[model samples]
Target: SSSFFGDYPDVVAFILIVIVGIFVAMGSKASTNFNSMFTIVNMAVIVIVVGYGITFADFSLWTGTDAEGRSNFFPYGVNGMLAGAASCFFAYIGFDGLATAGEEAKS
Candidate 1:
């Protein structure tokens, strides 16, 4: 029942964008309403992952020395922690638009 379309990048790209455009064409309220349940489910998944993942984390990976002589939980030191924090900050930036959802929602 499956056919291959790997050769058609343009078709694939167009279809992907068209599908996203359909969702974007739906006003924010409609889209937000449709996604609310999914959002709760996503949050639950995040919580579960964070809770269970810590138990499996190896304390050994946190220990190690980089090119520098200093050693700590972060092998690369404070700069590495700062860089990691910065990257995580940007990764969640897409959610900034969601903040306005409160105002966008109809009473």
Candidate 2:
């Protein structure tokens, strides 16, 4: 199951989300505005979580590499950088949700 989570993004991931949404919708979920609140809260949570992550991290860990340092986390040269950037591409989606949130509230 864990492998399925990352193996087939289209079939496994989309189907799981659709199944969950169906269940939630059947459960009499809140008005559309409720989703706006959730969206804003989710954005805030992402910001806070990312912000807080800085505290527990060792800045040196992303820097040096040796038997003692944790810096080798991205030893794969440009590939590591590419992977990190690609993974974070989705972080840019918050603004779109914000637009939907504003529209949902205005109505």
Candidate 3:
């Protein structure tokens, strides 16, 4: 008699992938039970970071002269802040995909 579960690499990989995918699906379903706890933990972490951050905040970095002896807090003024934000706009844009997922999540 010949067995179906022989030394086939492709078959083994496919079986493993399907098994893991099912496990992930089941785990995600179970995660809903702990969603509130996860939310509270996330909020606590944010609070702790903000609290500790203010304690060690250094206002001097915003002041002082640079190598060129510029005394302004913003060397390039508001334009520099705008340019920095513009560069990060793509990062913000990526969040739109996550936002769109909300619509599908409701179903």
Candidate 4:
């Protein structure tokens, strides 16, 4: 938003607050409809992007063999893969808590 709308954090915050207030005032039905519409649009965008990206993807890159005839599939080896898994686990660890946090909310 800052990139597209310039560096006006206060204005952006005000607009966001107004949008949230509108959604809240409109009640659950309107909010749910908007959420569903946004989800469909988001999925469409993802599909379009992935479809476009497939055109430029090089399947040979997965083999980790460069033009110089050197095979480096696992450059960092098993330790690197383990480290990456751990890093990703830590990054996404909070999401599960967020998903369950709403369970206790008044519906």
> Alpha-carbon error at 48 in model 2, in Å?
2.4
Pairs in steric clash, model 1: none
TM-score of candidate 1 against the unseen true structure? 0.47
Error of 4 at 8 (Å): 4.6
C-alpha RMSD of candidate 3: 9.9
Report how far off residue 94 is in candidate 2 (Å): 14
* TM-score of each model, in listed order: 0.47, 0.38, 0.46, 0.59
- Tens digits of per-residue lDDT, candidate 4, 28-95, equal 67766877888899999999999999999877766866666656566666888999999999999997
What lDDT does the true structure give each of the candidates? 0.75, 0.70, 0.75, 0.78
Candidate 2, run of 10 with poorest lDDT = 24-33
Which residue pairs clash in candidate 3? none
- Candidate 4's C-alpha runs over 4 A off are 1-8, 64-79
Q: Give the best candidate by lDDT.
A: 4
Instruction: Give the best candidate by TM-score.
Output: 4
Q: Candidate 3, overall lDDT?
A: 0.75
> Mind giving the per-residue lDDT tens digits that candidate 3 earns over 1-107?
88887666687789977865665467655545455566799999999999999999877868898898866578877888899999999769977996687446632
Q: Which candidate, 2 or 4, would have the higher lDDT against the true structure?
A: 4
Q: What is the lDDT of residue 34 in candidate 4?
A: 76
In model 2, which runs have C-alpha deviations exceeding 4 angstroms?
1-32, 67-73, 83-107
